[model samples]
Target: MAVSESDDEGSDRARGKWRAKKKQRPFWQELPILIVIAAVIAALTVSFVGRPYVIPSESMEPTLHGCSGCTGDRIYVQKLSYYWGDPVPGDVVVFVGPPSWNTRYQSIRSDNAVVRGVQNFFSFFGLVPPDENDLVKRVIATGGQTVQCCDDQGRILVNGKPLDEPYVKSDFAWVSGQQNATYPSGRVFGPVKVPDGNVWVMGDNRNHSADSRAHVSDELQGTVPLDNIRGKAVFKIWPPGRIGPVRAQDPQQN
Candidate 1:
């Protein structure tokens, strides 16, 4: 029969090219492994589920602003909120520099300490990308807690109470409207007690901050030691219509 209909039309054209390569071979090998597992789960949800910061400085005014001296507010830094404890009292942080303020926002991957220890271990698996010269403040007393500056409406007491701070900077408070304010007079003097571990920061643009009030060698200092803090400032993703959520102004004490 014409060689059995040409071997049954060459076995039905080799079974329709083996069912079109078993249906396009899993849409091209699982589309690049599902795009590298959705880019490592969106870089571990932007490294520890929350990231974005862009407030160059104005220290944090009326809750945060920027641009008169440059580098103003554009904040968001809440990587799993201190895992569950530690930095409190109006918390707004982003720290990891005690080689003396590590050269103001000095990027370029912190001049590679083996790429900052493999970007702090894949920044805990966001797969890497973080460290913007580092320095962002807020958190007015922790550890042994005492932080003082003024009490009678000159405000700034914490552990002695009085912290209403609507995000100060419209005639400052937290004591320097006559605190005898002679820093280095006792090395960040005052009722300043926070020690036992460390943590006592301030800057709602307190008259244009110089945090911890000058003296880590006096450049722009104000006691920050809880291992140079590194977390909190819950949210403010970015101008995609002012994202949302940002907390830590004593959100239940630390």
Candidate 2:
């Protein structure tokens, strides 16, 4: 069959129109939709999947650090990990700060509703530092377990078994001569048994950390309810060299 010139001209016009339409669309015109999609994904990730958290203190030193004026490892807490599974001993968890946790509410300003509303919005994506009302610590003992400091050899005993705590930070190296005798505070804690549904949390940097030991006077004896745990710290996301799975003491070892 012979091709018609009109057909060729019609196809050329259609191609020209399509090209013109493509040129008419500006990148900025679609930017809002992209922004919306990004915001939604970030919100969902922070809310129910994983959330980034800045290590706020040296309490988890060697594992995580928030040394004053120093860069700390930023971690992603696996919020979905415990949705169907229970938190076990040795999991590093982020949880709501107890009333006695930190008296200084550094990020909390005047109790203005509008101000709080804005803060909450930014906190959702972890854009700003988390409120002082949040804390991170390692689970020393879960429900029905008894945690005590220092066996005869100066090791933390959980459920009567001495933990192989390679992560516990050493005190001043020069102190010398039976450090446990000199530092009973870190070496000798309670024979306290964890109550059902509660878990005893402590900082890995024992000597420097104010954890369950500091809160023993409270009714709950510093054992946070399992329900209070937000999630487990699963990975280090920042500090490129430090990026890897967060070291968690094996719960099965307990």
Estimate candidate 1's RMSD in Å: 14.6
Cα lDDT tens digits, model 2, 134-203, are: 7889887888989876566666788888887667775323322344433325455677888898888878
In order, candidate lDDTs are 0.63, 0.78
Structural similarity to truth (TM-score) of each candidate: 0.34, 0.79
Tens-place lDDT per residue, model 1, 71-104, is 4555667667577767767777877545555545
In candidate 2, which residue pairs get closer than 3 Å at backbone N, Cα or C atoms, i.e. clash?
A: none
Name the TM-score of candidate 2. Answer: 0.79
The TM-score obtained by model 1 is: 0.34
- Candidate 2 residue runs with Cα over 4 Å from true position: 1-25, 108-117, 171-186, 251-254
Query: Residue 234 lDDT in model 1?
Result: 67
